[model samples]
Target: MGTKGQLVTDPRAAALASKAWPYEEARKLLKRYPEGKPARNGQPAPIIFETGYGPSGLPHIGTFNEVLRTTMVRHAFQAMSDAPTRLIEFSDDMDGLRKVPDNVPNQAMLTEHLGKPLSRIPDPFGKFESFAAHNNAMLRDFLDRFGFDYEFISSASQYEAGVFDDALKGVLRHYDAIMGVMLPTLRKERAATYSPILPISPKTGIVLQVPVEVVDADLGTIRFTDSDGEVLTQSVLGGQAKLQWKVDWAMRWVALGVDYEMYGKDLIDSGVQSGKIARVLGGRPPEALIYEMFLDENGEKISKSKGNGLTLEQWLDYGTQESLAFFAYREPKKAKQLHIGVIPRAVDEYFQFRGNYAAQPLEQKLGNPAHHIHNGAVPAANPPVTFGLLLNLVGVLGAGATPAQVRGYLANYVDGEITPELDALIDHALAYNRDFVAPTLVRRKPQGVEVAALERLDRELAPLPAETSAVDLQNIVYAIGNDGGFENLRDWFGALYETLLGSSQGPRMGSFIALYGIDNSRKLIAEALAR
Candidate 1:
């Protein structure tokens, strides 16, 4: 790792450190901590990079994107600076459960716990101590699965342990200023009842949003009216109270000295409000990157409560984790539609970038998404076959094609023995084809000139040897299409795909024939003509 005032020696790392988005983020950190550490109370402290999670529901793709992107930036910073750093995967387990999500089970049981902190509610799954603990474990499991290096901190644990005591005091001291920053953002009704602190009700155990009657900054206590119309005073420290989310965000920045964080574009206004509160609390808000949000297939914003977007598990079922990372790494500022239909393209593009990494020049290699996805440890070789080709192979081979049969046919095109990567790709292709492709396939019977052309093409292929090259077979098909009185050759190819493959779009006819065998192609043509 390069130290302060030390030049980056490796050309590729230097190029990437200067060009990649992660490195661009890293540069901001370098500016934040010029001497390799931030000064805290006249003592040097390790720089903190934090990602927040709301354990109100299961960890979704949005959670993964934040941590993954943050990790990328952390890695880039590590490469460019010798400063020690900490990545805190913070979970807001103390957050109130506003309502039941559409996805989880035991809805009635969860609904009963509404308005309580997630950590105080019983787990619906019955596997953990509380609902928040269950979701927190899930968050750690997936992050560990991705091999992310970080520390997990729960909000309930931190607050109950008095880790936020000093910060809580700071919040009490700046209560009026924080309220001044927050009130203008809320509607009249909400602003009327809003307080910087939400006291957990002593009798009902619900987080309350009542009006504060008195504030004692000196004693770290506040007097508020309970839902029963009783006046109560409680210390705001420890687990007695939690700040409103926007104020809590600022308090967290003050408590942890967070140096850098990123949020969705939708939170741009909230971020500004939190920054103002942070300033009021005598702390600087962290530098932030506002990336565009992911949208569902219908272009609606993906929400965890609605469970509208694809989960990490769903994406992993059909594509490699590296492919998903590649998707997250590209043009994060631009909105991208995330759905099952995008998997094949993402998988193919990932392999293409990986395959091209080695031969690329130093600058180009650094610029490639694969380099960052792999942390500069990109594999030397990738599977030669594309994900699209594999899907088409599965489609043409019919529903009963076993894995062994797919491997057997793949041997004809692959020069060397099949690698494990190829085997995994084949499995993904099989599942995707079975679930997504087969149901949508519509085979249309050839009509008009298409019928005669296909017959002529089948007859023309009969004389060709089984071992003919794909190029030669392609030339024969192209010639037949050209001479068969079809004004547009694409129509002939379309007819071949629609009639023979049962899809309007497919792999190269030459390659499909070579893999499926000339006899099989002829039989397919015969069957289509007969139909």
Candidate 2:
């Protein structure tokens, strides 16, 4: 039988609980461990927060996601408590180079380097000292640009310096126990020769996956035969050996005193295995928040191997960095499709979050994504025109329009002077339309049943008053499509978009037409009919 029910009420926690679920979750954790570590002078230790990346390929959007999301929760945690926090952005550069990415240059040069540690591989781009350094530099540049407060740790350097020597020894000492935890998850065949450690061959310096012949825990040594059939014996310390990934993950948590970490849903099984290993090694596992992976437009999980998602550069080229951060802000557990198609919506939502933050109550305001997106310093309000609207303006104003021409149209539409910030947004919108939209544009004639729908749409637009509201115009467009035998509103809308913008999709037609003016709209319709 259960104990007596208790109705608990804490105003502060309740307030956070009402706004963002993440903050609510953080608040509960803090409340549960009010007297956690390092209470030297009656003050609790700073929360040790960590996120890690495997530098196998160039750091992609997926890499940035963990940092972005972890930082968001860290921000929320700061609001909920006076306890200090530290976010460690660890890079596992010691990982063996499994395969050279197809996108990287000089693939022929990499055949000799396969199975070598990432830090030891030559930078194919010749821009950085090593492949790992290049990717790490790219990651640091991005973090610096975003002003993320974090400490970057390279596993290669840490290993070489013996920072994890003790933990590596512990893994070797408890070899059988670690195997008991890991082998059950592997195929029955793989369990036979698998070892917890992969040693760098003394001859070739490549990480060798050969079967470990012996592990002497008291001696702190492991013996394995290299591919050359040379019997090599190396001390498990001083970077001579590295534990397998899951064991390394667990050991890192124990060694670094990690209190919180976030992982992609794909790592759930690994997290469970690692948690068990951490517990077996007499260390507490860090709390975790697992998020679903991002997918490409095709609904396949976005992967470096698949080359199915936008690179950080592509996203920044098409939209603001804050917009990308906003994309990560919503529903962390829900799978999202990240493609160029989503950029416009993310930008518009960023603006909306910015506008709403000012008027929101204090409790709700702190939880607003814009609060974190701007790092608590939200910019001035933006013009009502959205990225989608600016894009429509680009198409309506015609391709090859200069920045000044776009600004002039935007000024007229929003009825305000375009600020420098807004002007920059316009620049990006035009570039996006040119790169992603313009090339996809087509001027196909309406065929059969669709032809009458276009004629009916033109007839309806001709009679509308110049002062008609966008709402009324939208309703009229809807009515015209239903009457012309194209009952599917989307079909009619597609025809109108292709006719006017040379694409199958554009901004809300009513607002677009209203802003473009009756004269301009009629001229475009006539041009479409002639085509």
Per-residue accuracy of model 2 over 1-531 as CA lDDT, tens digit each? 012543324435534554575675576557646665566477667788899988777667877778888887787787667778899999999998988788789898877799889888999889988899999998898788878889999998889898888877778777878888999999977777677788898788788766675557766788888879878788878777777889889999988878889898889999999999998877878888888988899999887667788888888888988899899888888999999889988999889889898876555566688877775788867766778878877866656878988765555566566777778788888889888777777767767677776677677888877777778888877787778777587888888887777876677888887777766787888877788
The C-alpha stretches of model 1 lying farther than 4 A from their native spots are 1-9, 39-44, 105-108, 213-215, 304-308, 447-456, 478-489
**RMSD vs true structure, all candidates:** 3.6, 4.9
TM-score of each: 0.92, 0.85
Candidate 2, residue 265: Cα displacement in angstroms equals: 1.8
After TM-score superposition, what is the CA distance of residue 497 in candidate 1 from its true location, in Å?
1.6
Which candidate comes out best when scored by lDDT? 1
Cα error, candidate 2, residue 308 (Å) = 2.4
Against the unseen true structure, what C-alpha lDDT does each candidate score?
A: 0.87, 0.80
